[model samples]
Target: MFGRLRAWSRRHSKLVDALVVSPLVLFCLLTLDVYKSGPPFGRYIGIPATLVLSAALITPLLWRRNRPREVFAVVALVCFAQWVADVTLLPADFAVMIAMYGVAARCTARWAVAAGLVAEFGLLLAVLRWDFSQLDAFPSMSVFVIAIWLAGIYANTRRRYVESLVERAERAERERDQQARIAAAAERARIARELHDVVAHNVSVMVVQADGAGFAIDSDPEQARRAVQAISTTGRQALAEMRRLVGVLRQDAAGGEEYAPQPGVAQLGDLVRQVSDSGLPIGFTVSGTPCALPEGEQLAIYRIVQEALTNTLKHGGPGVRAEVDVHYGRGEIVLRVADDGRGASAPWVEGGHGLVGMRERASMYGGTVEAAPRTGGGFQVVARIPVGVAA
Candidate 1:
């Protein structure tokens, strides 16, 4: 409740200021008669003059927040004019200090200092003219004015400190949100590459089998049956992989059933055999002792190999012979897929998402991929990845 009231008061500061200053304005008007006796002169200014001057001194405070220095200057000028006219001090004189407080709180230090000096000068002049016999009045009023000014300075410092803290907090939140967006975009790109590799390799296999089945449907019934069986198996594998990918996208963990873990180096042999059965003969070889690798690196290696062979199947043309080589070293691993085919000039060798995906995967593991047409014939893809590298 207090927080809400404070917020409302801040928003309606003009109204709050009016309410606070109303009582003071009334008191100054009621006590204007006190000025009739004291001073360098024997009689005060007339009641009408007193009322007009008091209004001039106090009314500008309504605009003090917006024009604090101007308000202070106006009130100080009126006080000076009253002094020049030999009129004694009035309660309305306190408005000069109030205006000084406003200047100290809301204006720059230069203006505040100027206002302070002006107020001090006016105080000295008033004490000399009216209270020279009573030395205590000068010290007491000087302390009170200094206290009000210091309180205003303190308030200004605290307000600026709070604003800086709020700005810093808001900036941190914006940076956090930007980081999250960048991470999310990177994750989406990773998933897109995975889908491309999985779908392209499996679908190319199914297409090869389906075409073979069509060609052998009558003359070689047994070969056609085998082709059909390969197609079914390839389709089922593709469906299962699609399900796993979908499950990964689910917001809830329980939204999808468990699937087999992602394929890695151990599953490369199965991948090669499946492609070989689809009619593109592939020679698979592995050298050096295999060592355990991080799951992400393993996935990168598997996808690189898969994308390479898929490119060969799509672009290698008829009766192409391909080779798959995996060499594990103490510090690194190398993967090479080369196919000798009549379609060596295919565009897949130069540019395609398949090659791009292979390079992206390899790069994640601090590796490089080189895909180009061999000097004699055929296209070759070579990937070298540093072992024990953290991406």
Candidate 2:
């Protein structure tokens, strides 16, 4: 019940203050003439009236307690003035309590401490001048006032500390979430690179074999059968690797089925044969001896060629011829795939994932891939991959 009332009072602060203070103001006014009956200035009817009015005005200021400095300054000033005037009929301590709580809750620790000191000093002066020796009084009033002031300072400090802790926790949680998102994005890009290597390598081979099988179906039955067999094997290999790549999405706590090896540079011949069988008339030429490369570098080379061949099969018209040349040198390897298709008459469409993936692959190896229209009426893709040393 008390908690509910306190919440409601907080919500309707202005109304509650008015309701509580208006009656007290009226009571003080009624007793003012009796309390000041001794002297001319005491009986000067406006003095008590002014004090009562000042106390009542403090209620409106208290309504703005959330704005601590403004409300504290106004209330403290009014209470001090009332104390100086010896206005006992109205309890100015009520205003002092509100100002103290406001300072403790909303103001900085330094300000709260300063306000508490001033209030305690003023209270000591008032007590010293007033005749309270006959009254039931505690001998430790100074100690009690000092303790309350210290308690307000401690409470303000603790509140700030708790708020700081909560801010830090929120900041840490946000940073953790941001890092998780970045990791997930990196994982997705890695998967894309892997998928491109697998699909491009196998699909080029299948398309070539399928084309060869179609051409020999009527002229040479035996060769057609061989082409068909190659297609089936290449298709199965592509499908199996595809399934392995896709299986990455499935969660496996025991770390099962994730240790599959990826394709690299050694499989370039298989890729070349697949493109040759597709019937686009591709010539493979290698200038230097084949050497082993890092798995990532090998995958990059494979993807660059795959994207080039896919573009050829899609855009290179009938009677067009394509050539793939690889030059393995002392420090780096240069792979170039060009197609002599119908040139400027068919403008190539721009902005596709194939081109972007090719570029990213080359960039990972600190290399460059350039795809542009050849001056001799063909499209050429020249990619260079640095190897055997840091770039």
Candidate 3:
């Protein structure tokens, strides 16, 4: 029953405070006349008048509970007035105790200490002035003073606990949001890398076929028709793969089933043929015995080669001779593509999307790529992939 009431009071705090304080004020006002009627200053109307004034002063405090400094100031003023009125007025001094607790919890520690000191000293002076020679009053008054100081201490401790809980909750929320952002950024980077490899490889092949068709159209009709057919087939294959890759961005759950088998090492011969038809004088040589590899490793090797040849075709000048050498071994596979062409004027010039894509693919397979101008002439790209390693 008490817990329910406490929860209800929290939900309707303004209503609860009004109901509690309004009746207490009225009762205190009615009893003030009785306390002051038999005083030393008999029939001195000042005592009842002060009580009435105190109640009026504290009524505003209910509305300003969160403004602890303001509430403390007003309640302290009322306590001073009651102290001057008579020691009998001490029973109505509970308002000052409540305000002291609020000051400790919401305001600075210095303010809480100052308020406690002022109230204790004023009460002691009031008792001495009244000359009440009752030993029983001392114990009760001491208990009341101790309770007020303890309430202030408890308020300060509780406030610290509440603030700590709030700080921890905010920190947890920030970390959750940061992790979500990191995952989204990583996904976008993967998509961009895949698109770069797909577009670069397919577009380079198409450009070569179109050039071949143009040259053969006037000299040999049969060869021109074959080149056109190759261009059409390459374009269609690229379109289908692009659709599969782009489907990754779709939100529909059913769209996830559209994934097609991606190219792997088995397609290396096909990749070589496409490059050969592109008009650059090229040769492909295989060393060591061939063996099967994991699907991911195969795909990685294919992308690395595709990116290297694309770079060669774009940057390697006319009549350039390019060589692709694949060495399949026991524990690793080494692939190299080198071009004897006009090397870049600034050898240290940064690479573009193709180079970055190649590096990313090689890294995915626990491998590395080295692309630089050769000592004799032109540029060389070497990639090595470790096979059958513990994942």
Candidate 4:
């Protein structure tokens, strides 16, 4: 409830100030009789004069927050005028102090100090004009001015500190959000590469099988039937791979379909076997211990191998023999895909997504990929990825 009131007061500051000053306004109205004194000695300033001056002193307070320095000056002038006319309203004196507080709380230090000095001067004038008997009241009034001044300064300091902290927190939140956006963009790029490798490899095989079937349709019915079966199998594999890529995009939605697990080191043998079945003579070998790897890195390794083999199929010409070798060392895994086919003469353009994707995937895992024409023979791709030792 207190929090709500504070929030409301902040929204309607002028109304809150008016409500606070209501009691003082009532006190001034009730105490007009206090100014009822005879002539010669008392100089009775009439009710009209007292009311106008009191209004001048207190009303400016409503705008104190917006224009505190100007409000203080107006209130100070009215205070001096009341003292000169020998008509003292106690509420008017309080208004001067309140005006000074507004200045000290909102204005700069120089202005606040100037206001404090002006107020102190007004205190002296007040003591001399009104209280010849109670001279001790001057010291007490001076203390009140000093205390209110200090309180205003403290409040100003604390407010600035809070504002700075809020600004810092906002800045940090913006940076975190920016980082998340950059990471998400990178993740999308990786998925795109995955889709490219999967589609390219599978479609290339299907196209090869379709061409073979067309040639053998009238000559050999058995060969044609086998080619058609291969095409159907390749198409199904392509669809499954596409579903995996699309699954990442829909994972955030409700009732998302379960997706096939991403291909990893364990899936490499099956991958090689599929390519071999597609009429590519390929040898697959794994040496040393196979340890656990992060899913992303495993995906990287899988795509690198797949892209390398795809490139070989597309460019290695006829009668090419390809080999995939995975060697797990003490704290690193090495992959080498080499094919003895038409090497440097093949139209494998540089800067294409095939080799570039492999490099990007390896670099993401603090690894490296090198693809080039092998010495005295065909093309080779070597990738090295550092990993934790198997426990």
Candidate 5:
């Protein structure tokens, strides 16, 4: 309830202030007969003159927050007029100190100090004009004025400090959320590349093996059984790889699926054999001595090769011939896949998701891939992947 009230008060602060101050102003006007002797103006007009001056002094406070400097100047002029005419200090006289506090709290330091100095002068005039017989009242009034000024300066400084702290905290939170979003996007892309490699290659092999099994069921019973068995093996492998990828998506560390090891360059021969079963002949060659590499880099090379082969199978015309070449250098590994077919569209030029995925994977390990049409009549994919000694 208190929190709600504070919010509402902030929204209608000027109205609230007027409600509180209006009564005090009325009281000051009611007690206007406190002083009997003053300049000719006060004596000639009597209570009406005192009431008018008191209202003028207090009414300007309603706009103190919105126009603090103007309010203070106007209040100060009325105060100086009252002092010169020897008007007695009333509760409405407190408006001058209130105006000074507003100026201090809402404006800069130089203005606050100026307002404080002006308020000090008014304090002296108020002390002389007020009907206080005790000498101690003089020192006490001065202390009260100084305390009010100090409070305003402190409030302003503290408000600015808290605002800065809140801004910094909000900025840090935004950056943290942005980083989380970027990491999630990167992980999703990685899983997508893995899923494509697993399903496309394995499903393609299963389809080919099923076709072979159908062809040989009556002509060669033994070849038909072997084809069916190969299909089973490929299906099981695909399921396991899929489980691992799914486990990664769920972030389930306890799941055994995610713990499975990823395949590397050593699996290339098997990959080649499976792809060739679709009636496309492909060649595999290694030009230099091999070296072990990080799991991430190895995965990148494997996926790039897999995507290239899949593209060839999909777009290469009938009776396509493909070749894969790998070279191990002192500090880098290079892979090249070339196909002799009329129908394969160059990925870099044509623009496809598979080629984009390959590039994203290679860039993670600081490598590069180029896919374009071969000069004569085919498609070629070449990648240069830097390496570190296997850990």
Candidate 6:
């Protein structure tokens, strides 16, 4: 509630100005009457002239916030005129100090510094014209002017320093938001690629197995039973994998009963068996020692192999041979999928999402992939994935 009231008062500063300046005006008017019997106000100006000059000096202070330099000028002029007419000083001379503060706080440093010097001059002129006998007052008056001017300068410096800090903080926040957006978009794209691989490969296998079951059901009951079993197994594996991919999209950090682990090179054997059951001759081999890898890299390795084999099943000619070779080296894991099939004119360009996803995945782990038809005939993808050494 106090904060609200403070903000409201700041917004209605004109009202606050009137409240503050009106008292000074009243004081100066009352002092004009006091001067009638007190000191007669410098032998030249009378009550009427002092009242008029005091009004001109104090009234402009009401607009100090809006036009600080103009107010300062008006106050200076009136004070100088009062000194020339030799009028007595009034309490209303406080307006010049207030105006100097406003100018220092609102205007440039050069103007504020220049106004501070000019304000001391106005003080000296008023003191000399009114009471030269009060020469002991000069040092105190000088200190007051210096202290208040320094305070105004300090306030201006502090305000600009705080504003700079605020601007830097806001800029950092915007960059953080932008980075988050980019990460989200990249994750979405990764999920889409994985989804495509899971759905397309598994569905293709199931479709083929179903056809085989249908054809053999009437003639060879045993073969038809095996085919049907293959379809059911393929369907279950696909469903589990799709669930795992979908689970990653869940923002909840809790790993509950439905949580399924992502696939890695260790799962390559199962994938080979599933694809082999659908009538593709697939072989898996490891050339070097395996290392413990990050979950994301493991997923990438698994998906690249999956997508490559799925493409072979779709595009490789009859009795085509496919192989996956994994090599765990000093600083990286080398994964290669090779197929001795009737390769396309540009085997890498035959599919869209498969090659693009492979590159995106490998690049994430600071790796690279080379996908092209071999000179001896067939397609090959070689990915070198960087990683820390296994413990």
- Model 5, total clashes: 0
Give the CA lDDT, 0 to 100, for residue 249 in model 3: 79
lDDT tens per residue, model 4, 152-257: 8988888789879979999999999999999999989978898899889999888778887999999998999999998999899899989878877885755756
1-391 in candidate 1: lDDT tens per residue? 9769988988998998888789878997688666555544434777898888789988899988788888888999999988887776777889998999998888788888888889888989988877778868898889988998898888778878888998999999999999999998988898899889989999999999999999999999999999999999999999888888877778886844678799999999999999999999999999999988888888999898888888888888998999999999878999999999744577554567888888888887789999888878898889999986433
Among the numbered candidates, top TM-score falls to 1
Scored against the true structure, residue 61 in model 4 reaches a CA lDDT of 93
In Å, residue 377's CA in model 3 sits off its true spot by 2.5
Task: Give all candidates' CA lDDT scores.
Answer: 0.87, 0.72, 0.75, 0.86, 0.81, 0.82
Cα error of candidate 3 at position 168, Å:
3.5
What does candidate 3's lDDT look like per residue over 1-391, in tens digits? 9768867977887787677567557766676666544665212446656566666556755854567778878877766765575434533566776676667666667877787776677667666766467645766786787687777778788868877987998999998999999988877887787788888778887887788799899999899898888888878888888888788777874833756798888898888888787677778899998887878778878888888888777777678889999998777889999999866642334667778778887887788898888887788999987776532
Q: Evaluate candidate 3 by giving its C-alpha RMSD to the native, one decimal.
A: 4.7
Which lDDT tens digits does candidate 6 get at residues 177-214? 99999999988897898899899789888877887788
Model 6 / residue 73 / CA error / Å:
3.8
In model 1, where do residues sit more than 4 Å from their true spots?
1-3, 37-43, 83-86, 128-140, 252-256, 342-344, 349-351, 389-391
lDDT of 5 at 240: 91
**Which pairs, if any, clash in model 1?**
none
Q: Estimate each model's TM-score.
A: 0.87, 0.67, 0.77, 0.80, 0.74, 0.82
Worst 10 residues of 1 by lDDT: 34-43
Worst ten-residue run, lDDT, model 4?
35-44
Model 3 score (lDDT): 0.75
Q: Which stretches of candidate 4 lie over 4 Å from their true place?
A: 1-4, 38-44, 77-90, 107-114, 128-136, 157-187, 251-258, 315-320, 340-352, 373-378, 389-391
Which ranges in model 2 have alpha carbons more than 4 Å from their true place? 1-67, 70-78, 88-98, 108-158, 192-208, 252-255, 280-294, 327-333, 343-347, 386-389
Which residue pairs in candidate 5 collide?
none
Question: TM-score: which is higher, 1 or 4?
Answer: 1
